[model samples]
Target: MTYPSYRNYVREPVIKVAGTGPARSGTEVWAELDRAGRSRSDRPLIVVDCYPGVDLSDLRKVAERHLPDYQVIDVEDAAALPVAEIDAKIADNLTDDRVFGVLGRQTVDDFYDPDALRQVRDQVAGRTTPVVLVGWGALLVGADGGQPAGTGDAVVVLADMPRWEIQQRQRRGAPNWRCDNGAEDNLRKIKRGYFVEWRAADRHKKHRLFDAMDYLLDTTRLAEEAVLITRDSFQAGLTAAAAGPFRLVPFFDPGVWGGNWMSEVIGLPPSDTNYAWCFDGVPEEESLLLDVAGTIVEIPAIDLVLQRPVELLGERTYARFGAEFPIRFDFLDTMDGGNLSLQVHPLTDYIQETFGIPYTQDESYYLLDAEPDAKVYLGVRDDVEPADMMAALRRAEAGAEPFDAEKYINVFDVAKHDHVLIPAGTVHCSGRNSMVLEISATPYIFTFKMWDWGRLGLDGRPRPVHLDHAERNIQWDRRTDWVTQNLVDQVQRTGAGDGWVEERTGLHELEFIEVRRTWFTGPVEHDTAGTVLVLNLVEGAEAVIESPTGAFEPYLVHYAETFIVPASVGRFTVRPSEAAVGQELATLKAYVRGTERAPVGRPVHDTKEPGLS
Candidate 1:
């Protein structure tokens, strides 16, 4: 649960109008007084009247007698004017920093309805400088019909204008002062509706749980914010109101429901919904959807296929994938000198022929919190005969051309946030003492260990290794170094490159996968398409998400939890807590969709279909 810092002090004012008719006696006088109060009389007043019997010129003339200088535009049949044409006219007249006002019929017999009024209001509400409604009809801005434009307990209405005006005048407040949401300033055109608030947690039970919690809260916060922002202007307006340091958004977790429905009900990517870490506490035998490692839908997070969705704001790219099944795997954590079997993954070509599958296993490492000097074994150091490699494995000995973990494996100093990509053909193994965020094509941990030298698992049993698969797909003829910098000749940090977008945060949209380091100054809006999951560091600020169901409090960075942004949710946003430093808002590792479709021609290995379950 996170609340955006910028949301706390800002107010989104929605003006609701009522009654599509000329103001009767008392109403007309009140309207005139309101107009005068909103403007500087030293300049001429401009009024545009629409429709039969109501003449704005007459009112202008009446105002001129008192002020002596005023301009008024009278259109006998404003309703007859085309909406587009009328909009242009309004735009032209309201140009400049002029103190402007609009008075229109809220309802017109056969032609006007609530929607029409809303459309008209949208054109003028934000632009008319200072506006006052001049009709008796009711306005509806929040909670549908439950609260009329100006009344109800669910909302806060500020009436008693005369008293407020007197107090302001006594204080010698300038006539042109911008109105705050309070009554003393500009009266709310629509009453404040009930807003959901979430609680932010400052601490978590564990410290190493950053990666899992980061994706969960950040993704969830955006989804929640989108719902509130898209549903109502006021709600959208309130999004940035809850300032940061600590904030939370209360929302319903669709994962609480079981099975595939999680993706459908929440409307996020299939990968985004299921995580082994999410259902960790559940009895493993009870048909759990996720595992301790946060492997959702059986699909491991560490892979080349990164599917973190970001909702677009204003205008942006869009893409989505439907849900499918069979994405499953277990994640292993290592300590000290951790060991894994030297393995080979089947490529799309072999999988299709042998398993009747077309998909290839491409995995990547999202190093969450790594220990110093950690390394992973990648490809062989040099080429050797496939037959010789097989003989070495059979004899339980290191092969002649065996690769050194330091030289062949793309070795990095292994900081807390390092990310490394591992393709299908790359033989690899995770070294010791590092927390990892694994993103992969699927959860098929098919490995062929050419040599294990009798390593033991914690259970005091020899760690299992597969050799047949290794010999079949070993790329003996091609064994160049697999480190990114060594492989790519032009690896400058600044200049420019093609194929991907990389920042100091690491990489984004590399190949079909995009990874980003994001910091939000205010609420971030997200939309439905593919599921978006986030791994975030609470650091100092809080992250909150708002949704149609309600608000959720994911809290600050210390608490680790995975937040899922469903594919079906229309949109959502994330904001820092009030005390959050704008310069250091929550840091995030995010994944968004790309235009290149997943390789659909091939089927997945050891299972069915094209997607991770």
Candidate 2:
């Protein structure tokens, strides 16, 4: 899934808290802590083990103001290894590259000084009053990854931060962990988080902290007041939210080549800033906003994958991908903007061998909206030579000359609702004036940008071009003829109902994702079939997603909204909502290739809806 919307897009989608009392906040949070402390016989240890990039400033301020009597212990200052030591420790994962790094496999203890931790432990053990330990690895100071230890009675709280917020913090001059490099390039900061910081944080919490924590703390909106929820309520919120169709709170960011389509269509306020990418369904960086009573509790969407893997991703998917959401849906709005970078993704073997990632990025662009003049660069032209193309790109990058993209690339006229399957190693990018719904495997951010239209980044620096890497991955054999015949408009009408039609869209046989577009005026039956299904309301104003047996509350989806159905959800139905009762709406759904039911029969053609094509 990718990380990083419109139709008055629900800016903040919240899941109703079910089967539990609301989360504790304000003075109520302090009351819960005081009660726990008073009940303990020995010194009480309240440990808030935080993920990297958490705003410890806010946390400390809140703590000092609320629990004045508790002795505050900043673990980083007392026990964390020095920054130089940390750099030396994770240097293997933080490769020399600015934009990429290997996913780390370290634990919280790996970055701590054992002697310093023992000193802190002794200091805590000698305390007669309540001790509040905070920082990235505070829980490890007196407890063995959340279990009982000799540091007196402990109440563990996981101060978790979502990936998107961390990225925002990075952009706004926040360093990762204690590495004092806040002014680093945004790309390098994200790379550090993805490669070292986040992986270590996740490894630290995936089992130990998640299970042992007494409370889950909201580390989002660092500038605002933080919320604290009981661990039981947190788990309940996740369980209830993941059981049915749900949408992760989407994140939008302006890009150098962004467009105004999102602002105009999604009802974002008028601004010069163009919203280029809307991370609608990428769970890795998205958060689930849980509405407890009236307060909104924000938690990472990955919590469901980590805590409810079997239920959210289904048994089969869990077996195949472990605790991970494999597919992602996102938007690439180039409407009224410049073309995206001429980029190519690394192949599976290349990503595995070079980057240590198990999978490659196999993606497809489904047009949600397209200006008539929209042109998509898909593959190499049949007449272009690989060596010549490489030389041209090199010369262009060196500023010796401008690369003539059209001379060597296959540019095609695109339209709304067109599905363009892009397997790895195929050079591709969306041209201006097209709203693309990118559906793909989850390994984003490994793109090799061959060309960027010879423009400097908004930062006034040259956008890094990786022609050397691109040369290794680009599939030269995918010429114009092959692309035209195999990739373009490869749709087949699989079946039809009274008021609905199902068509199999192209994802190519080389890729693992399968997409199905359903055009309907009445209810359309859908089964998860043991795999999580993600979809978008591609061609409708509004539609209602329902569970056949009332397993989930009927969910309303608006035009361009993306939602997910857990594998355990089983069967559900989609129909036009009250406002769209008579209009024919369409949804483009994607899932694992083998998990879905076989097409009803042999393929048929030209069965598209009246407005399509």
Which candidate ranks first by lDDT, i.e. highest? Answer: 2
For candidate 1, write residues 239-265 as lDDT tens digits.
Answer: 222111111121111111112322222
**For every model shown, what is its TM-score relative to the native structure?**
0.39, 0.95
Output the TM-score of candidate 2: 0.95
lDDT of 2 by residue, 326-391 (tens): 998999988888899999999999999888898889999998888889989999999998999999
Highest-scoring model, TM-score:
2
C-alpha-based local distance difference test score of model 2? 0.83
Q: Please give the TM-score that candidate 1 achieves against the real structure.
A: 0.39
lDDT of 1 at 598: 33
User: To one decimal, what is the Cα RMSD in angstroms of model 2 from the true structure?
Assistant: 4.1
Clashes of each: 101, 4
